[model samples]
Target: MRYPAVAGMFYPSNPHELIEMIEHCYMHRLGPKDMPSLGCYEKPIGLICPHAGYVYSGPIKAHSYYALSKRSDPMEETTVVILGPNHTGLGSGVSVMDDVWKTPLGEVEADKEFVNLLWRECEIIDLDETAHLNEHSIEVQLPFLQHLEMLNIIKFKIVPICMMFQDYETAVEVGYFIAKIAEELNRRVVIIASTDLSHYEPQEIANKKDMIVIRDILNMDEKQLYEDVVNYNISMCGYGPAIAMMRAMKELGYGEARLLAYATSGDVSGDYSAVVGYSSIIVE
Candidate 1:
């Protein structure tokens, strides 16, 4: 019964206004024309998206979802597992939510069955609904999923994972395990890593620093990605989830990744100083 935080500061508070905002982004930004159609390939195993406010990050986020829009399967037929960074610092490794997440669009029911199964298979994951409360990283993604239309017909569950102080080995092992379970269940899943790239740096500096991490990601170099973030003191908030996604994608047979789009808050607000960077990436 915990409705938690609604879209006010992050997105439009009014229901109709919020819907319009999402639609406008999708309509204007059609995503990369050079990329392969979503229907042409196997369902994406994972996606890396930013979680900044709609005004700043919405267009880039739309591009990420556009990549999935061409999938032949109905949204109802797909269960998206959105893995987001825990800004609240509550959960240790991974936190699973059993309750439905409410947004301006409507109530998004959690995939409790899948959550339970993950809990049984992985000792590092636990059910903690509190972790989801007031956490915008995961919540910001639900409206996009709802707007897809087909999602209304499919029963989808969400698993919000907040990784804390976990080593690279642990993340990789967890990713491998999730892939194995998804294969066994014969369920089509999309892993979304909700994170912004760099924070509070000059626009040029932020973009430069984020590109280094992005390059490593596109190369599928998990070690190099981690090292670059640490070595440069990069403020990319979702490095843990990105590492986890890279690990999981490799296990799922996706060896290559492409940078679909990259933009900064400065792009939207026309300010170059102290901006957050956002990028949309897909692994296939």
Candidate 2:
């Protein structure tokens, strides 16, 4: 079993506290005022969300989950493929974890079949659990998913991938293969790229710098995004994962992306001198 890595740190360890914290996130001033509603039928292909502490980035993450819950139909056979940057440098350049993930809400089963298939077909993707053992980027995302599951809004098996290398070449290759295999198998896939933008910069500078990368994402230009990251030194932590998820969407014929919300840690802490920018964007 993959135990919770950031359970007590990033979020609450107690199950009750965890649930309340998630609810508070939904009701936060920056978050979507109302709870998730199954009002639409168009499924989302990909999303870009910030992976930070609940007090800092959870509201921002809520925006993405709210967008996810919009699909009116039940997500029966859906697989959530989460791609996060390897902050801890513990495993392969591109690694996938095949194990049941435990969270406060309950245990979520990994899509072993999906893992096995991708490992065989994608030469660059290695099966490694060490990368995820101490990585909070992917683990922090589970509570939101677990909250959604508790609501019976969706049911899914997850396939977690950690990218230690966020280079353009590796990201593009990984994204391409994920879409390729899912399409071949006729499987429904929803991708979530875990990221935070413009870390520890002044609010004004962070917004300006992040906007450049955000524009590239909204335009669905992964190459230009990489360029923006490199040329501007944007400090976006998960650009590689974003690039990968964007590539997968493009492969699956998604052309447009909508920015649901954008905010900074300063907004919550009232410390504008230096802050981390977070955004929630969904691809349609």
Best-matching candidate per TM-score: 2
Pairs of residues clashing in candidate 2: none
Query: Model 1, 159-191: lDDT tens per residue?
Result: 666665446776676677667767767777788
- Give per-residue CA lDDT, model 2, range 54-126, as digits (tens): 9999999999999888763465657889999999989899999889999888898988888888888999899
Q: Which residue runs does candidate 1 get wrong by more than 4 Å? A: 2-6, 28-41, 150-155
Flag clash pairs in model 1.
76-154, 111-157
Q: Measured by TM-score, how close is model 1 to the native structure?
A: 0.91
- Per-model clash counts, in order, read 2, 0
- 9 Cα displacement, candidate 2 (Å): 0.6
For all predicted structures, in order, the TM-scores are: 0.91, 0.97
Measured by lDDT, the strongest candidate is 2
Give, for candidate 1, the lowest lDDT window spanning 10 residues.
31-40
Error of 2 at 251 (Å): 0.6
